[model samples]
Target: MKIIVDRFISDSESTISHISVDQRFVCFGLEDEFRAIKVLKETRIPAGTYKVALRTRGKHHQQYIERFKDIQHEGMLEVLEVPGFTDILIHCGNTHTDTEGCLLVGTSAHTDPENMSVSSSSIAYRKLYPLVVGAAKNGSLSITLEDNDR
Candidate 1:
């Protein structure tokens, strides 16, 4: 599976993006603002291609399994080996403040200069999780993060 995140709008506090899988639209994504100097929990990962996998262990995993009981949750969709970052996962949230450096997904998006947000987050996540897990099962999964929406 090939996932692409087009980070189109970036500001002081948030980066708003759209996500696609295998050239098909998936959802909107939200991440922390890009920063030359990395700040823990507040900086977006660098633009790069990274392998993705299902992280079966972690607090996020445990929480998701419970919260998404109807989805047959496999594991968190983790973006692997991002330089200077760890435990980067594609999950769900409403705003940049909820991201904590992880990618957040939603059905709809809104962006302003300093604040970016998304809505219907859990609904988006429920729709996305299975597709990623199925891909992981069938073959390889990877994601390319880029600033292409300019």
Candidate 2:
């Protein structure tokens, strides 16, 4: 399955996760886990195909490699050559700037951009958590910046 995570909606972003399961590709919304019913978000990577790669930062490095290995081992999704090297993968961030060079997903259990006591309540988790969880469960998600009414 060639899963495409398109972000072409208004006021939010979207993410598509492909999990390796018994030599098969399972593309779904990461947000589905939380029973989220909405899709799409602000700031998208435009309409184009890009190669997916793993960009690990810290301790999760091992987990990131495992994910890529699983994908290749199962023959589910193959990495492609994207112009300008726009690599996308699971990373940590709370806002648009957090994305930096890659797709910024939910925040980590330890690091919350805000100093607030409630980490989960942070903007990152509150907005991205539900969306990603839903995507993972649904097997495909698109994020857009355009209003539905428009």
Candidate 3:
């Protein structure tokens, strides 16, 4: 499986890393717009087609352990599954003003010293995560982000 994120298109100063495998696509924590953490044995994901899955615990994610009780009951911290139509992703932003509900990268625009203001974790989640997750889950061998420089 291959995962790609474009920094130019991302909100500045985001930290992305740590990808995990569930039942479908490889899941990851979004570090930055240009960085993606993919789960595979190889250092680089081969360019091809593959499927994707998103492992989300839901809105009560802070109560993650209780949210996905079954997974947690089994002693697992992260929940794994295809995102389906939901735009849940381990992305940038915090639980405050910066997040707008999606996973965050920087604490917030004010917190990030680099002055990255255009990217929204929620927006990025809406625009990018689904497409990548969809491709990965549907059996697309390779996942690519064109880096639109948004």
Candidate 4:
């Protein structure tokens, strides 16, 4: 499976991207602001292609299953071998604050009334988790991140 994230909407606080699997739309994604210097929990992961897998062991795995009970399967989708980053996963959230250098999946993107940034999350994750898990089972999953602004 090949997942592509085209980051198109960006602001000082957050960046929003359209996610697709093999040319099929999947969801919107949220990440933290881009930074020239990496800042813990506040910078987006560097754009690149990375291997993805189902991670069964870890706090994120347990937390995801707890929040989304329907995800009773095995593991959370994890992005592997990102240089200078660790534990980067495609999970659930509404805003940049929810991402600590990780990707957040959402159904739609809208400016947050309070923050002037994008939100509307969780529902997309509910829809996406199962599809990604199924893809992982079939073969290796890889994701490519591209900054459309560039």
Predicted structure with the largest lDDT when compared to the true one:
1
- Overall lDDT per candidate, in order of appearance: 0.87, 0.32, 0.34, 0.80
lDDT-based ranking, best first? Answer: 1, 4, 3, 2
Q: Score every model by TM-score.
A: 0.94, 0.33, 0.30, 0.88
lDDT string for model 2 (1-150, tens) is 133332212222323332222233322222111112422332334335443332334444554446435332212121234333333343444444444334443323221222211122233323433334334434443332111211
RMSD of each: 1.3, 11.8, 11.3, 2.2
Model 2 misplacement above 4 A: 10-44, 53-80, 106-150
lDDT of 3 by residue, 27-101 (tens): 233333322453221112222223344444455344534533443321211112323212333444442334322
Per-residue C-alpha lDDT of model 1 across residues 68-119, encoded as one tens digit per residue: 9999998888888888899898987888889889999999988877767999
Q: What is the lDDT of residue 1 in candidate 2?
A: 19
- 3 or 4: which has the higher lDDT? 4
lDDT of 3: 0.34
Model 4 Cα lDDT, one tens digit per residue, 1-150: 889999987878888888998899988888887898989888898899998888888887888777778766578788889888888888777777788889998877875533533345667877777777877765578899999854
Model 2 RMSD vs true structure? 11.8
Q: After superposition, how far is residue 134 of candidate 4 from its true place, in Å?
A: 2.9
Cα shift from native, residue 36, model 4 (Å): 1.9
lDDT for residue 116 in candidate 2, whole number 0-100? 12
Worst 10 residues of 4 by lDDT: 111-120
